[model samples]
Target: MADLIFYTNPQSRGQTVRWMLEEVGAPYDTEILGYGTSMKEEPYLSVNPMGKVPAIRHKGKVVTEVAAICCYLADAFPEARLAPPTSDRADYYRWIFFTSGPIEAAFSNKAAGWEPTPERQRMFGYGNYDLAINTLEKALTGREYIAADHFTAADLFVGANVNFMLAFNLLEPREVFVDYARRMTDRDAYRRAQEIDGRLIAEMQAQQAPQPA
Candidate 1:
C-alpha cells in the first residue's frame, strides 16, 4: 500500500485534492466513498468524522479540509516545489487562508441564498460577496500565480475554488478570473486529474442508471 491514501468522491470538492496530488507527482491509493454510505460509515468516518470527502492519510497522519490537505501534500513532498520557501511564504499563507476562509464563506452563503445584511456585515468576515470577490480579483489582476512567482499549493486551492464557483455561476466570468483560472488549470497535472475524476464520475453514473427490462 502506498504511504498516501486519498479518500474522495469524484463529484465533490475532492477533485481539488486530486489535482494537488497529481501536481505533487506522488504515488497514492484512492478510496471512493458514496454520499451517505461508506463515507459516513466506519473506517472512513474515523479518517474524518465530518463525513466529508477529500481527506488524506499520510504515513498514519490524517489531514482533512481541502486547503490543509493541499498544504500538507506540498510540504510532505517538497521536491514537487508546491510551496514557497518558509522565509517567503507571506503571500502563500495569506491567500490560501483567505480563500479557504472568506472566499469560501462568502460564496457558500451566497449559494444558499443568504447574504448578510449591510448592518450585519460586520459580523461576517467577508462583509459581502462583492467585497470578497473584488479583493480576490485584485490579488490576481496582474499576477499569473497567487503566492509565489510560480505555481504553488496556494494556486491549486485558490484556483480550484475560482474554477468551481465560475462553473456553477456563483462567481462572475470576469476577464481576470477567466484568464487566471485558464492559466492555473492549463498544466498537465490538472488535465490528468480532471480526466481521472471525469472517468470515475461516468462510471458511477453508469452504475446508478436503471437497466431496461
Candidate 2:
C-alpha cells in the first residue's frame, strides 16, 4: 500500500495537490474522479463529504481542501523540507489562509457576478477583490517565497492560485503576480506534476470525445 491515497480530477484544484505531492516525493495512489458523475456520488463522497477534489488519505487519516492538504503533507513528510520551522511560521500560515479564504472568496464572488457593496465588502472575509489582489501583490513583491526566504508549502498554495488566476483571467495580470507565478512554476516538482496531470487530462478528454458511428 502506498503511504498516501489521493482522490482528485486533473481538471480540478487537484492539480495543486499533485504538485505538492511531487514536491514531497511521497508514494501516493491516485483515484481520478469525473465531474457530474462519480464525484457527486458515493465512495468518493465518503472520503470527502463536500464532494470536493484534492482530498488525501495518509496514515489512516483523511484531509480535504487544497491548502490544508498541502500543509498537512509537508508536515507529515518532513523529509520533503517543504515546511518552514515552527518558529518561523507567521508568513506560512498567513499566506496560506489568506489565499485559501479571502483571495479564494474574492475571485469566486467576482466570477459569480456578485460584486459586494461597501457594507457587504466590510462584512466579507476578503474585504474586496481589489484589496485581496493588492494585498497578495504586496506580500509577493520582492520575495522569492511567502514563508521564509526558502520555499515552503505556503508558496505551493499561493503560487498555484496566482498562476491559475492569471491564466484564467480571474486575477489581474500584474507584473508582480506574473513574475512570482513564473518562478514557482519553474520548479522541477511543479513541472513534473503538470506533465503527469496534463497527460491524464488529455486521456480524459479523449475518452469523453464522441465516438464515430
TM-scores across all candidates? Answer: 0.98, 0.97
| TM-score for candidate 2 | 0.97
Worst lDDT run of 10 residues, candidate 1, spans 140-149
Candidate 2 lDDT by residue in tens digits, 1-213: 887999999999999999999999968899999887889899988998887797999988899999899989989989989999999898899999999999999999999988799877778898888999999888988887888988899988999999999998998888999899998889999999999999999998898899999
Q: All models: lDDT?
A: 0.95, 0.91
Per-residue accuracy of model 1 over 98-210 as CA lDDT, tens digit each: 99999999999999999999999999999999999999999999897889989999998999999999999999999999988888999999999999999999999999999
Per-residue lDDT value at 130 in model 2: 91
| Highest TM-score scorer | 1
List pairs with backbone clashes in candidate 2: none
For candidate 2, the C-alpha RMSD (Å) to the true structure equals 1.0
RMSD (Cα, Å) for all candidates, in order, is 0.7, 1.0
